[model samples]
Target: MIRFIITRLLNGVVLLFAVATIAFFLLYWGAGDIARQILGASASQETVDLKAEQLGLNEPVFSRYGEWLSNAIHGDLGASWFTNQPVTEAITSRMGVTLSIVIGTVILTAIVATILGVSAARYGGWRDRTLQVVSILGLAIPGFLIAIFLVRIFAIELGWLNATGYIDFTDSFTGWLKSVTLPIIALSIGAMAAVAQQVRGAVKDAMRQDWVRTLRSRGISENRVVYKHVLRNASGPALAILALQFVGLLGGAVIVEKVFAIPGIGQISVTATTQGDLPIVMGIVVFTAALVVVINLSIDLLLGFVNPKVRLS
Candidate 1:
């Protein structure tokens, strides 16, 4: 287990390094005279040059990348080029809100997907076919459109929830719940559809295995055999899908944040990208890459712990 974990961590580190390298160079080469853009066209040549120097744009691109990467290794992500706010600080401030939504979506998806999947597998009738149809539709529709529908129905028409804006949990727990509920649901629908299908397939496959019959023959109760042995075997794959869903949610959260008016990492990401705020943008890129690595590592570790073959390998 220890060896497995260590190997996974090393792999994650390599992946993070690769992502940071690509993100850094792409932002650097593609951005095109950020200082000039910041200073505007009317600014004189000398002033533009000074602005470039101040922003470190005049430095060799490779040298700047080296400095940035080195500082990042030492836990110094630098400051926002526009606001001059520390990159880490800026991200952390809104990180919680984004995480809260994503986490809620995960939990909701897990519970609902499990129920639907297990049921569809067990019943295997009209319910199974019906679920397949709905799941396909759920997967096909974009998350933002669903969010908009939710906003129109729940927030505007019914006035049951807030259409836009965020509330801090510290300020009011109820308000915060109301604020995040729609976003979480919007994200969860697609995930639920996808995961439920995986779970259903896994469960059905497990039920068909000879081990299930062997257990039943040995006098194990039906429910116990199905829930304990069958579900356990089914869990491994569903868990992997869940991790992938987490990554998807992060991407989707950007649009969800804008539609819902939540000041999360996603919101800041949009603003930073629009303004060519490279420090903030780079910081976010690194943060996202790190987030993905950590989540994937955790899942791999979980799988290793759950399955002896994986750990032994």
Candidate 2:
């Protein structure tokens, strides 16, 4: 297991390097004259040129990439051009908000999906049909639309919660949770639906396996046969899908954050892009890429533990 973990960690490092390289070149290539964008339209040509030179934009892409990569390795993600704050500091400051929402939604999704999926699979008929309809509705609705509707009903009409902005958890845990509740629900809807479908499918497949048939034939209770035998076997695939979804939830939270006005990495990224803050944008991209790599590696390691055959392979 240690050997496998080390191997995966090394692979994650390589993957992150590749991602950083691609992000560097792509941002430089796509964002032409980043200095001008940063300096603004009214700035003189000479001033813009000087600013570009200051930012090292005049250097070859490969050279700049090497410098950025080297600094990043040392935990220096550079300073934001607009805020003049360390990129890491800025991201870390807002990490709590994003982490809270992501963790809450993921937990909620897992519980809701598991219960609904198992129930539907066990009682396959009207209950299954009802769950299918609900899942379909979840998939069809857009998160932003849900956020809007939630804001209207809960924040505007009923006045139960604050509709805009974020409150610090340390300041008021209740307020923080209340404020983010709608956004979390909105973000979780699609994930819950997808996970439910995956779990239902996996459970159904597991129930048809020969082991399940034998267990049933041996006069094992139906609940034990389904939950203990079938669901346990079915959990591997469901867990894999859930892990992937957890990573995806990070990306999806960005849009939900924007709709609900939560100050997080996603909101910061969006703001930096609109303001043409190249440093912050690159920092965000690198950070997000690193997160994805880490999540993937963790999932791979988890799979090994969940299925020893995978470890042997």
Candidate 3:
């Protein structure tokens, strides 16, 4: 297990480096003159040239990339070209908001999806059909549309939540919940639907396995056999699917944050990208990649723990 973990972590580091390299070059070469964009069309040619020189845009792309990569390795992400703020500071400040939504939504998704899935599999009639239809609808509907509908019903019509605002958890827990509830729901529904269907299939397959029948033959209670043996064996695939959805939720948060006016990494990422702020944009990209790598590695480790066969690979 320790060897497996170390191997995964090493791979994650290499993956992050590749992501950083690709992101830096793409933004540097593809996005035309940052200095000109910052100064605008009205700025004189000489002024733009001087500004570019100041930003070291005059330096070779490889040279600048080397400096950025070296500094990043030493924990200096560099100051934003546009805001002049440290990239790390800007991202860390908004991390809380994004983390809150992502974590809350993941937990909610797992609980709801698991229950609905297991129930549908156990019953296997009208209840299962209803859940399947709902899951299909969830897959069909985009998250942004769900956000808009939620805002209209829960915020505007019912007045149960604020249509657009974020409350710091440090200020008040209740206020924070009120602020984030709609966004979480909007994000969770799609993930829940996907996981539920996958889980339902996994559970049904596990129950049909010879091992389950053998356990039942040993005089094990039906509930004990299903919960302890069937679900446990079935959980591996469901967990893998859930981990992927959690990553997807991070991307979806970008739209949800924009709709709700929440100041999160996603919102700032859009701002930085639009302004051609290389340092900040790179920071966001690398951070997002790191998040994905870590989540996947954690899931791998968890699966290895739950099913020893995974560690062999």
TM-scores of the candidates are 0.96, 0.93, 0.96
Q: Residue 127 lDDT in model 2? A: 80
Best by lDDT: 1
Ranking by lDDT: 1, 3, 2
* Cα-lDDT of candidate 3: 0.91
Q: Decide which is better by lDDT, 1 or 3.
A: 1
What TM-score should be assigned to candidate 1?
0.96
Regions more than 4 Å wrong, model 1: 305-313
Q: Write the per-residue lDDT of candidate 2 for residues 145-191, one digit (tens) a residue.
A: 98889999999999998898999888998899888888888888988
**Candidate 1, which ten residues in sequence have the lowest lDDT sum?**
304-313
Query: How many pairs of residues in model 3 come into backbone collision?
Result: 0
Regions of model 2 farther than 4 Å from truth:
217-219, 303-313
lDDT of 3 by residue, 31-97 (tens): 6788999999999999999999999898899999999989999999999887799999999999789
* Each prediction's RMSD to truth: 1.5, 1.9, 1.5
Residue pairs of candidate 3 with colliding backbone atoms: none
Between 1 and 2, whose lDDT is larger?
A: 1
